[model samples]
Target chain A: MIQFHNVTYTYNFNTDTCKDAIKNINLKILPGEFLAIIGQTGSGKSTLVEHMNGLKKPTVGEVFVSGQDIWQKKFDITKVRFKVGLVFQYPEHQMFEQDVFSEIAFGLRNNGIAETKIESLIFEALDFVGLPHDILNSSPFDFSGGQKRKIAIASTIAMQPDVIILDEPTAGLDPYSSELLLKKFKDYNKNKGKTVILVSHSMEEVVRFADRVIVMHNGEIKMEGEPRKIFTKVEELNEMGLDVPQILKVFLELRKLGFPARADIYTVEEAKQEFFRLKNLTKGGKSFVK
Target chain B: MLNNMMVGQFFAADSIIHKLDPRIKLLLTFVYTLLMFFIESMFIFTFNILAIIMVYKLARVPLKILIKSIKRMLPILLISAGINIFLIQGETVFKFLGINITKQGLCMVSTMIVRIICLISGMLLLLYTTSPAELVAAIEKILKPLKIFKVSPEEIAIMFSIALHFVPVLLLEAERIMNAQRARGAKFDSKHLKEKLKAYITIVIPLLISTSNRANDLAIAMESRCYHGGENRTRFKILHYSAYDLYALLISLLYVLLLLIFNKLDFFKIVM
Candidate 1:
């Protein structure tokens, strides 16, 4: 539901140390799609996602959300933000309310949602993030880091924006919590049919959940396609300081050894299926095994 | 908006002022500011302004950047000058909107503005030429004598440097928190004062929380690294005074002498 046309953003503009954070970005996000943006550090992933919610206006081009130009004169930017929720990196540090209930209700209240409906929405968000209802009265700061991250996510999801953009949502979390959190976002996108744009560094997570992947390097979009297609260019990705999933690396090694295994196998499940299929082919007696 | 803050910011350049000893620069700035208050004549003020302009040229700092730095103080300057124009009572030279504008008021306002400008420019010149580390070292050197009173100049200097280093970090954090609040639909640009205050509350609470959290983490990290309050620690770069420092001190002494001479000369003095 968000589109960027020739968007270029420069930080510290008009200063001697001015830098182009993102340059000449032309992108489009479809409704209900799980889009993952992968890049090295300072590769403009955060800047690109920040533009989706109009948090950072592009210095050069136009960003359109749901067919409306967000930066147009007289356009209400708050409205755009309400429709496109952004969960910043280290979002738990942005928590301010005294308790979990008020913390989750903060966005709903700011968006002028009905007072009576805020409680229900907060409960719904807590449910979505797997937080319990009993801890609503407790202070958010008293929770563990993962719980705090869930509370932060609940705070954003309470607003129920049509498009949710998360910048490194799973950063600093354990692997299990990261996977669980990504699953929640997947459920949110699948069940609600809402657009989800994730800025991530994990190739495995992107290959697992992302319907489309966009690789960024040096303030420009380097590649864009399905995960399988994107992972096929392992050398190019490595040159840009990015890596493919481990399963794909194994399959690539098999291909190099004269085995006919598929090189595009990303997830472990796909690798298992490919292994069985190869075993079945080898069972014909004329084996191609190295 | 916070990026416009030029206080404590250094502009790196290869110039005589930038190469001079930081201790000398600090002392000269303090002495120049003191001398600025002793001036009683327009001629001395003009002379000080010319001297400041010459120093600016010697420092090789761009004129536009200097003007931009001064522009941030325009509101305070105008407000103070406006108050002086209307409130100071003397011979009424003119009237505007039923308020008398006195000649003494005009003279006092001019002197006040000149003095403030000279003081600010002198401080800014010192900051623009000297890096923060050097400034802290110079401060420690100046306060070294206080060691006799059970004070640790090294610890104070480390604290000062840390405080200076965190200013930009906190500003960046504040900006991030502000954007996060805005993304939550908080309207910071509202015209109502109450709404604006409410918006800022969201930013302030988060900023304070993060600041303390950061401080705690930094303390732990320092402890892990065996940091022991700067006792018996060696420095990487030691401060040294050269011939240029002596030259700078002599020039400032001459400038102070000129100010004293002009204070004695009543021919160019303006009666307030």
Candidate 2:
């Protein structure tokens, strides 16, 4: 489990221009849980997630990972980082190797894995991300935008980290590619049972993929719960400068129109099922409005 | 760790220095630097120090930031002083470890050190008060006259501004790549220089590739907008020299004249 104790981060400390980024954050992230950290821009969601992998340290509090303070002396913070793979926003900028194969292999090499097993690991990660083997020999910079995103992701996945943290992974991709990537993340989370922390702005993606939701406003966590429970409080979230899923909004409007519909449907699939059930109920020619 | 760097960073504030026109500020900076060459005495240097302090007071930049900026130049300051001690051969006033330390050498090193401190402090004051956007605007305006000689000042301005714009972008990219590599267990701050160099190579290669990609994107965007470089382009904000600018220029001129008067009197030898 990853835990934060009264964590607070102030950028440029002791300076007049210092800003309180995240304040007194206390939370725990259980292993193998798909948690989505949702907040508007500049709400400190990124700062909160960046602490999980030791990219940043809390100024006023301690962060514990698996019963040990990772920032303490002699803890091998780099090893902690290796176990918690962090894919930053626009992670494609991390691509360094000439070919796609080498790009993916870079991580494994850092982990000091044997040369004989590195090739297979690279292929497994590529296959996981649905990247073609034809681009293995070509320069990684030669690919299309979506393909580059996949290759960059594959570079992180080859490490087989215990916890994979992605910051706005699908912000710039096409709809189909984003959906494909989200599905891949779900498979990674379920099949491998690794922790997946997705920092996103899209409530729809959170509703579709995440099992738990964290809502943030300013520099504090406003609420946290299961997706269904969190989306049910539509007014509270909207007040924090965030919107619920479109389906939830649609259902809320439907209820206002006196349809007696559920206002907490979070995903398209859930919306479809609810609408079909409502359609069948109305087809009986009995008064279902009550 | 790179965040501590204060050189070329703007400190947002509303002060007399910040209110001065950037074009006038740039010109005054140039003139002040030229005047530093004629200061031959410690008294003149002392006066320059006072003048710099007064400028800093007007700029309202915190002393902590100035110290941080000068700290980055500490190594250069020491190295210059060390080398000058041996290079300036004259009447040897003292001996240390069988090496002669001349009176002239000591004078020159002190002057050099003071000059560097003043130069850096003055330049950082300008940078601290003037935002990068304003700096670029000032440069484009100052160099506008070069267009008559087929110099293409607008293209030069565009390049300058783009390069300035990329400093922070690339710094953030480097941090991202650094973190990504660190997550992969790449030891960047190894004890051995060779190991550190190798690790840097891993980070720099990607930065280079992304730079090319960014340039291509910028070119495409510019072309789409019909950017044909400096042909009858009208600026949104025209450069205006107000009474404050005139006052600032006259003050700078008076300061330089004081330095000349002090140097001619050989008044600093009393302190020496």
Candidate 3:
């Protein structure tokens, strides 16, 4: 479990230009849950999420990963990092390695895993991300942006962290690559039972991957609930500079158009099922407007 | 951080120095430094100055950059000159207020100043033309034979690469911290030593905080890739030398040989 108890981070703490990035907000994530954190730019999403793995210690509060306080001197911070794998936005900017195999092996080497284990782990990670083993020796820089994205995620997966946090993982990818990455992440989460947390700007991604949606506004959580529940309040999300999923928006507009449709759909699959049911109901020729 | 740091720093131009192997460059600087320490006459110093000019031109570094580098070392230059001019035991020309001005002392100070400037500019010219990435590439290649000794070149390359990558980030953080302190009414421009000291201290503390945070994030990013230090790793883009590189190396050798020959025979010391 990961917990943030009244965590607040003030950048430039000693200087006059010090500004609060995150206010006193308490948050908790249970084991094996996929949570999506959504907020406007500069809403403290990055700062708040970085604290999950002891990347940033709170200035005023505490962050606990598992049962131990991350800041305690007795606990190894590096060990904390091994459990929480974070893939930064534009992670490709840090890719200085020659090929995919070495790139994926970077984390394992840091953990001091045996060379024999490292090779197998690298291949397994590449396979898990749908990249071929033959591409191991290929330069990461030569790959397409989407392929590089997969390699980056595979790099993190090779660490075998229990909790994986991705920051704007699909910021600039085609819809096809984006869907591919999301599907791979879902498969990883389900098959490995690893906790996945994503910070994204896309409402559709949040609706798709997130089991719980966390809406942050002005360094505080405006709302937190299941996607279906939180997204139903379209007005609240709009006020926070966020949007509900397109399907949910369409149903809300349908209600405004005097249709008896409920606006609870958060996915295309769910929307398709609901649309078929509505079509069948109307097919009975019962259009008596009382 | 200071964004302007990237204006021309660490860019590899097609200059002669950029083509020289890093090991050779390192050797050149070491030789230059040693020569500067042993050489005393103005004529030898003049030879050093000419060598400096040759490098400055060959590296394609602007004269203004050499001047800027010298400017930062002005305080040390002045202090060394002041001590030499006042304390050295020599033939005194005049004495004013118990201060003696000697003929040899003045000459010594001049030689010292010129030697120091020449030494610094020669090294700075090397850095100005060689990109950090290219330098690391060269270093990794040079260290490749270490694999016979069971050493890892990839680990060394990664260390240098990470250090180079953070240079810009560190400078940017410093700029932000300075601006933040300025916004808080910290008088960085104050002439008072104490106030300036306080302002600098304020700037450094926050910059340190940001650096550590960046370090943490960078560590995690590095670890995820299974970066075991220097073990059985291959490179992506291997560096190679062309005919131009060989030509540049030949010219540098000829220049150094000319300097060495003149110094060995003592043909130019009379000009001092």
TM-score of each: 0.96, 0.91, 0.55
Q: List candidate 1 segments past 4 Å from native.
A: A277-290, B229-231
Q: After superposition, how far is residue B209 of candidate 1 from its true place, in Å?
A: 1.4
Candidate ranking under lDDT, highest first, comes to: 1, 2, 3
- Tens-digit lDDT string for candidate 2 (B1-272): 65544276888888988988999899888887777787767777777788777778888877877887788899989998998898889999989888999998998899888888888887888888988878888998788888879897778888988998888888877787887777666779788898788789888988898899899999999999998777688876676778888888888888778778878878665444
lDDT of 3 by residue, A1-290 (tens): 89988999998787656899999989999888899999999999988877887766799988889978999877767677778888877655445466778767766765678998898888888877788889988888788877887887888888888898888999898888788888878877888888999999988888878899899999998899988788878788888888878888888877777667767877888889888877787788866243
True contacts kept of each: 0.84, 0.82, 0.00
DockQ for model 2? Answer: 0.73
Ranking of models by TM-score:
1, 2, 3
Cα deviation at B183, candidate 3, in Å, is: 32
Q: Please write out the lDDT profile of model 1 over residues B1-272, one tens digit for every residue.
A: 66666464888999999999998898888888778888878777888888888998999977666678778888899999998899999899999889999999999999888888878888989998999999998998899999999998888998899899999999988889999999998889998999999999999999999888888998899889998755688778898888988888888888788789878877677576
Q: What is every candidate's C-alpha DockQ against the true complex, given to 2 decimals?
A: 0.83, 0.73, 0.02
DockQ of 1: 0.83
Model 2: C-alpha RMSD to truth? 2.7
